[model samples]
Target: MAAAASPDRAHRLLVVAMDFDFYRQAHSDLTYADIDPAGHYGAAGWREGRDPAPWFSTDAYLEQNPDVAQAGVNPFVHYLRSGYREGRAISRSQFADAYYAALANGDVPITAAERSAAAEHFDARFYQTMNPDLAKVGIDPLDHFLRHGWREGRDPSFEFSVADYLELNPDVSASGVHPFVHYVMTGRHERRPLKLDLTFRQAALGRLQSFEGRLADARRWARPIELTQLGVLAEALANAPARGLHLTFSHDDYSRSVGGSQLCVQREAAEFARLGVNHLHVFPANGWPTVRSGATRTPMGVLLNGETVGSFVPHDITRALKSYHAEGPRSFAIHQMLGHSSRDVVDIVRAAGMNAGYFWLHDMGSLCAGVHLMRNDVESCGAPPPQSAACGVCIYGAARSGQLREHELLFSRLDLTVIAPSQVALDTWREGSDFGAREALVLPHATLVPSDEPPPMRDGPLRIAFPGTPSIHKGWPVFNHLANRFAADPRYEFFHLASKPATGTTARHHHVAVTVDQPLAMRQAMIDLSIDVALVWSLWLETFCFVAYEAAAAGAAVVTSPESGNVAAFAADSGHGLVLRDEQALEALFESGEILQLSRSVRRPGLFDLKFSRLAAELAPA
Candidate 1:
């Protein structure tokens, strides 16, 4: 029985004999070999020593295996046997007889005519017993028998009488019914048992369990508030003697990198959670961790489908949120209330049931081209725009042009509070939009002043340094013109600190020295070279010039254009810098010994010291 159960056992005996006999029969037909005593009698060889007897007997050995005679028993049978136990043969007729008997006894409650028709159907099974191959391939031999076995004037398509169905299945209408009707109603086909190996099955089950556990844990950690800024949120939670503050950091410009900005943000966020800051607003676009405020990360729920659904696939958002929330944030803050894309982001946050806040970046109205005070199609920092029109042009243009409706919608929809990086930015907002002047607060840009001692001055021609990339708008042309004019005189020297050599005809100028693209090395060289004056000649309205700050911190007298927005503010406050509107004013300073005095005063504590305190205060918790 065990040998019969294996497909390999049948294959080995059957395959060997079948091949031997087929070749032997072919060899015999090709020659006249009725009887040869030495066993070789063919056209190719009739020699006495050569023999065909061994092959003939090997063929006979193949015909003797009993397993071959049992035609119905094959590998497929053994496959079925692995799942089903052997039992007494339930002949088709006997099964039908019981079926009808149960129907008649009210165990199966079908009509009398149905029972008679079913009995006729039961008689058809005898045909399938005669031809088992038909049954093996899923053809119902009994149905074939009933229609054409004896050709008893019956059409194959004739509808089955109700009596026929009831008669074939004896317990068809019985209260204790078989599973047939239920299976038929559900359209379910019988499936073979799965045969996964033990290790694989265990692994699949474990993965399913882990998925369920993570979902359960996420549900338990859901929060109700939303605060965006990490530091503010952390502080609020720490000082939450009354209620937890939902804080969020929404301004993109404020969330920039300093020496250790990322680390500071992360550490502060963790501290906030420890102090009970439950809500954190994370902007994934900025690469901030999503769930730093709380233990659970929530999605920004926006309805994204059809054409509106961009490359921002749901799977991507889900993965990002899960990774972020896994960091164990206490809460979330959703941001950017002024643009269409931001609105989409907010929608996603809201869908996750997260609290959201609107964050304003810059005054969209005055910044846009239409309302901007233009000079030859260019806007300069001559005078500020009116309060009402400041953000109007940009906002209207964005809506009209369909450029950033999503961002504009975010600004339109959310309950927003404006946070500005500088007092100037806040003032610009007040004069520009209906959002009201008081709605904005001055959150100045944070800074870090290096604590190196002022080195002694060296005797040499004053090194007037320009520390950034020389672009046209950054007054590179102005510097080029100054260097060309000064190269004619040997008294004053000029140095261009940049990544590449100065391009064009200006490269010929002797005073124009290039330090080529080394930022760290160039900065240190400036200190060692004892640079007297740092020239910042920007033609554009800069919000803040970081190079100016760095040079001032290095104890260099700064000479910048008055139009360089915050440069004037720094010069007025620090006394460590000078602002000049025209070349003549700069020339007067250079000639009157004022430049020398300015360089000497640059290292004074009152000038550079105040800058350090201002920076430290800006970075401190509000």
Candidate 2:
């Protein structure tokens, strides 16, 4: 009698495969009863030729596995107990039925009507081909899929890409719904896109279209985006005595913002003040400067000696300066021009008749709009040649090409002296741009001084940290990767030291707010925490990294990648840390327990304030 199936075994299999709701609804008589569905199915439901679930048919299972019928036993109980492991195939109504049954079980979370709809889109043969292991086992492909295939990134048919769909719709993945079923039953109706992989040309065109759209949106702003006016700007310049004023151009206000570039500008302004030269700062009032759409007016803010002079359109500012031919002597310093029109800058330079202009490489915005040479805001591209395939794929590629052309014209028109914070930054910029500047030189933002005392040894897992905001260009991804890799390992603990905490990373956060007033906050925190290693794995070639210095000051040995620009250079020159070739090597160092050795070599850092010597020399005596 087919070895009379064990009651315990039969009950367990039936409980897992049988959809109680489907069974209760399919058999109306039991819909109002309180009896267990499995008990009722085992007692008399199968005897009356009833199905166990929406997808499993008694007649179909018996027809495929005739031995169960021959034994005069329940087909689903037999199939789940042995037929599944035996690789039996249910070729007829089984595929669609299994697809529906899988959803009816509550794991897929689709409505009965949607489950019915999802089954119609299932291509059995296509699924079999997509999942050869299930097909090779001669098992019901749809059944295996509903139970586990979707979790393994296996697609059900040609209509959907499981991995791409899950990646595109994280909410669906998080909700634990089968991607194909979701796409077929809901995603299509919701107008969700399919086939996310676009060709090179299509991707590039899409990026360009997006960029143009932002530019168009930026142009649509009202005439006066800010509260200030052109009259105030004109009045400020009119009151000027015109005694060789030093005009500085940046993307934003330097006084309020906190950044290496802003600090440099402030320091340079201080030096200019010391030399008795008037320092006038001009920047795009709307953040990033763009070409005005025909008659669309964009405001530019002006600051003189740390106070707001006024805001005016670039055209009016240039005109006002031109009208006053009270030019005594003028030297221009372009701290940054991220949001300012190169043409506007040229107009201002020409109007003021700037005898010499110094363009600081605060970032690679001069080379590409994707400043820091970070491609698509993910990883560094090493300032590849314009129009190269690398640039073509980047959203900022087209804009970079145009910016480079404008820079070339600007360089040709004015005698610009290029100043980079590091030799590597200068070399990278020179390799990517042919601006033909009158001079190019390096003026480091800060110098490192070694302290007499060595770091104290602490008995615990190495405390590795990533300082500053968790930004992609700052190597947050790499740091996060390391944190995830060694999270469970007892030898290491990861930390994020910044003003704010980050999400989706495996690092313990310690809020270290560093501002102009509290510049040593991060260093003090690192010292208090006894941070062993600082991961300064910046993706871009940093002009200068304040974090590396901060780590050194805290007596922490820095672990950095070779492409970290100034961080890597500082580590090698200062002997404050080690520079790794790649992520693999970094992982290996952690794996080998050699990171503990690095902590032993940590030397205290002292500020060697060179104090902008070359910059002071450049701002000729008034």
Model 1's alpha-carbon lDDT is: 0.40
Q: Compared with the true structure, what per-residue lDDT tens digits does model 1 show for residues 1-622?
A: 4345444543443343222322232332322234332112222221221223222222222234344324433322232343134431211221233333433543323345543444443423333432333344434444333322222222121222223333444455344332222223321334311122233223333444332344356456544423233333223324433223333433222223322122223333444444543433333332221111211232222211100111233233433333333222233333222111444454445543444342433323223322122221122433334233532432222222232333335455555556554565555445544542224455443353556565556665666777666664466666665654454344466776654556421222122222112223434545655666777876555545656666666667778876655666676676767788765687676666466665543444322321311221222232
> In candidate 2, what are the lDDT values of residues 420-464, reduced to their tens digit?
888888988889888889999888766555555455556677789
* Pairs with backbone N, CA or C atoms under 3 Å apart (clashes), candidate 2: 55-97, 288-339, 289-339
Candidate-wise lDDT, in order: 0.40, 0.73
Q: Listing every candidate in turn, what is its Cα RMSD in Å to the true structure after a full C-alpha superposition?
A: 32.7, 17.6
The clash count of every prediction, one per candidate, is 56, 3
Whole-structure CA lDDT of model 2:
0.73
